[model samples]
Target: MNGPGPWGPAVDAQGAQDVLVHQALMYGSRHEYLLTAVPYLRAGRRAGDAVVVLVEPPVAAALRGQLGRETAAEIEFLDAAQWSRGPMHALASCHDRARADWWPRGRLRLLAEPVWRGRTPLETREWKRHDALLNVVFAGTPTMIMCAYDTAVLPGHVLDAAARTHPELAGPDGPAAAARYTAPAEFCAECDAGPLPPPPAVAARRSFATGGLPGLRSFLFTEAARLGLPEDRTLPFVLAVNEVATGIIRDGGGRGSLRVWAEAGELICDVADPVRVLADRFLGYEPPGAKGHDAAMWAVRRLCHIVETRSGPQGTQVRMRVRIG
Candidate 1:
C-alpha cells in the first residue's frame, strides 16, 4: 500500500525510483474536497509524515471543522496567497520546506490550494508553468502534492490544465494516472510557444553598448516614471532593468537594445542581446545560489511584477512588467 503510486510517483514504466507524488484534485464543494483531504491527512499522520494544508481561510475552517480539535491542530495550515507569491519564490519555498522542515523526519503530505480566482491570463500561465516545474523541483524528495481546483468557479481551461500539469489524479476512491500529463520540460516549453508581442510603435526605445549602461538605467527610470510608475516602483524597476542590462554586458556580449512602454496600465521594458543563448531553462527558477545569470535573473523576477524571457534563434530577450496603478 505504501509504495510508488496514487499518492506517490511512477516516474517511469519500470517503477522508476520514487520522488515527488504530484496529483490534481477537483471538487465542487467543501464536502467534496474533504472527501479526499481528510483521509489523506489522517493517513499521513499515521505514517509519521509531515502534513501541511495550504488553502483559503473558509476552506481551511471546513477541513478543521471536519477533523475536530486535535487532528486539525496537528497539520500546518498555510496561506495560499503567501506560499504562492511567484514561480521562483514558490518553488524555492517548497524546496526549502521539504529539505529543512520535513524531508529527513518523514515524507511531506501537502494539500496545496493555490488562489487562481483573480489571476490575469498571463499570470495564470506562469503559475501553470510553476506547477509543471514542481515535478522536477523535488525530483528525489519524498513529497506528495495534492493540487486542488474548484470545479464550480474555475473555468474549464483551468481545470483541464490540472490534468496536464499533474502526473496523477486524486479522487475519493483513490488515485489514477493522469493520461494527459506532460513532462515538465515539454510543458514549460509549450507555455512559451507563443512569441511575445513586439513593443508598440509609440514605445520609448534605445540601444546601449557596454559603456552606455549607466545611461540605460537613467533612460529606463525616466521613461518608467513618465509612463506612470509610482515613486516607490521607479527604483526597483530601474534595478530590475539594470540587472538584465548588466547581465548582458557580463555574459550576453557587450551590447543590447532596450525598449520601454506603457500598455493596459502597466509599464513594460524589454532588453535584448543577439549574442546570448540560454542553456538552462531553470537558470533563475531556484534561489540565488552563486553569481551568474541565475542570480541576476533571480533578482529580475523578484523586482518585476511579471517577467518573460525568451532565448533562441531570435536571440535572447527579457521583458519585465509592473502595474501602473
Candidate 2:
C-alpha cells in the first residue's frame, strides 16, 4: 500500500504515491561511476536540494576533483567506512542534515555507497539488510537515495541482491523501475526466515546467568583476541555482545546462552534466551525513539558487522559477527 506522495507527485510500482526514489547504481569502472553520479549530483545542486554524498574516500576524492571546489563544497560528504556503525544511524544522520541549516526548505538528495571491497560476508549481509530496510525507513519523506554498488569489486550475488532491495535502478542513461525489486516488508521477511548456519562445532559455548555477565565479556575478549580481531575492533565487538547479553538478562527472563566461533577469518557470536522480546521484524532498523524497548538491539546492530534476529516457538536468538583478520 502507498500513501500520498510527499516529494511532489511521483508514483511507484503499485501506483502508490511516494516521495522516496530509492535506486541502485551498479558500475564496473570509475568512469561509469562518474558518468552516472556526476549528473545526478549536478541536478540536485541545480534544484537547490540538500545533497549529501557518502562513499569510499577515493570515490569522494574523484567526485570532488571533477565537481571543482565550489560545487564540491556545496555537497556534504560522509565516510562510508563508518557504515559499520549502522546504516540506520547513517540514514538518520542524513535525514537530520536535510532538516537542519538551510536545507529544510528543499528536498533531500543522497548518494551513498554503503558497501565496498574487502567487506566480510557478515558485513555484506547487514548492509544488504540495510538496503531493504531503507524503503521502510524513508517511505514518505521528500528524499531521493541512490545506493552505489561497485560491480567490479562486489560479487554477482551482491549485485543481484541490490536489484531486489532497490525499487529502481539509476544509471548513466537515467532512472528506471527495477524489474526484480521486492517490496520492503516482503524482503525483510525473506531475510528473517533465513537464519545463519549454526555456530561451528569448534565454537566455544557457555550458558550465562545474571552473575556470569563479567565472565561472558572475558570469554568474548579472549576469543576475539585468539581470532586475531584487530585491536580497534576488539572493544566494540565485546561491547556489542555485552549489550545484547545484558538485554537478555534484564528483559529475556534473566538468563541467556553465549557462543563464540571463528570462521572465514571472522568472529561470530550468538546470544539466545527463552523470552521472545522482539515481535517486530524492523526493531533495530527503526529510528531510535521509535525503537522503544528494542534500543539495545539497535545498539548491537550499530556496533557489529551483522546483527541477525530470529524468534520462534523455541525462543529468540540474536547472532552478531565481525571480521577479525
Candidate 3:
C-alpha cells in the first residue's frame, strides 16, 4: 500500500515468483498492526495466493470486522497464537501446506502473531532459534510469512532478536531489509552454543549396547512410572527414549547411556551416545524422507513436553522432558 513490501512487484497468472519473503512485524497497537497486515492480505488476495491468517481470536476478529465479510470470506483463518503445538510442528505444517498448495496457486501468504507472554527465557530462546531456522527451512519455497511481535509486552531482547531472525522488517510504511539480520545457520548455532546443564546426580543411569534395548526400555519405563510421571505420557516417553537408544545401537557407535531423573517438576530422560556429527540441521522438522530418520526427530519432539538436543566433543545427547504437572 505505502510502497512495495517484501512480496515484491505485482504477480499475475504465470508470473509467480520463486523467492521466500519472511518478515517480522513489530507492532504495539491495533492501528500499527493494521497498517501492514490489511494491505498485505489484500494484495495476496489480488494475486490469487492462498492467504492464511493465524493469530489470536482478538486479532482475527479485528481483521474480519475491518475487512468486511465479503472481503474476508475468501481467506482461511486459524484460531491459534504461537504455533499450534510447537515451532517444529508449525514448521512441518507450513512445509506441507506450501508443498501441497503452492503450485496451483502462486504462493502462500501467511500472517501470524507469536505468543510470548508466559514463556521462560529458555523457551523464548528456542522460539528465536526456530525463527532463524525458518529462513533455512523455507529456502526457495513460494511463500511469504510475516510474524508479528507485540512491542509493549515483549522484552527488549526478544524484540531485537526478531530483527536478527527475520530477513526483513515490516513497518507502517513498508518492508525493508533488516540490517541486523543474521544468516540462519549462524544464528541457529548461536542459539545452541551453550552447554546443557549436567543431568541431575540422582538420575538413574544405565549403559547399554547392541541387543540390550528391551532391558533399557524396561528400566526407563519402570523409573518413569516410579517417579510419578503421568500414565498417559509414560508410555510415549519410554517409546521415544527407546527410539533414541535404538538409533544409538544401530548407528551411533553401537552403544549409549540412558539417564532418567526428576527435576523441577519435570521428568527428564536423556540418551547419550558416542560423539557423532549429525549433518542435517532440520532433521526432525522436515517432512518425511527429507533426511534419514528425520521424521524420528519430528516424533520425538512432539512426544515430549520439551526436548534439548546437542552434539559436541562430549557426545551427542538428546534429552526429552515431560511435565509432571
Which candidate leads in TM-score?
3
Candidate 3 TM-score to native: 0.89
Candidate 2 lDDT, 167-187, residue by residue in tens: 889877677779999977777
What lDDT score goes with residue 255 in model 3? 91
Error of 1 at 150 (Å): 1.8
How many backbone clashes does every candidate have?
0, 0, 0
The TM-score of candidate 2 is 0.76
Q: Least lDDT summed over 10 consecutive residues: which range in candidate 3? A: 1-10
Instruction: Give Cα-based local distance difference scores for all models.
Output: 0.81, 0.77, 0.79
- The count of backbone overlaps in candidate 3 is 0
Query: How well does candidate 2 match the true structure, expressed as C-alpha RMSD?
Result: 4.7
Per-residue accuracy of model 3 over 54-78 as CA lDDT, tens digit each: 8988899999988889879999888
- TM-score comparison, 1 vs 3, better candidate: 3
**Which regions of candidate 3 are displaced past 4 Å?**
1-16, 82-84, 100-106, 290-293
TM-scores for every predicted model:
0.87, 0.76, 0.89
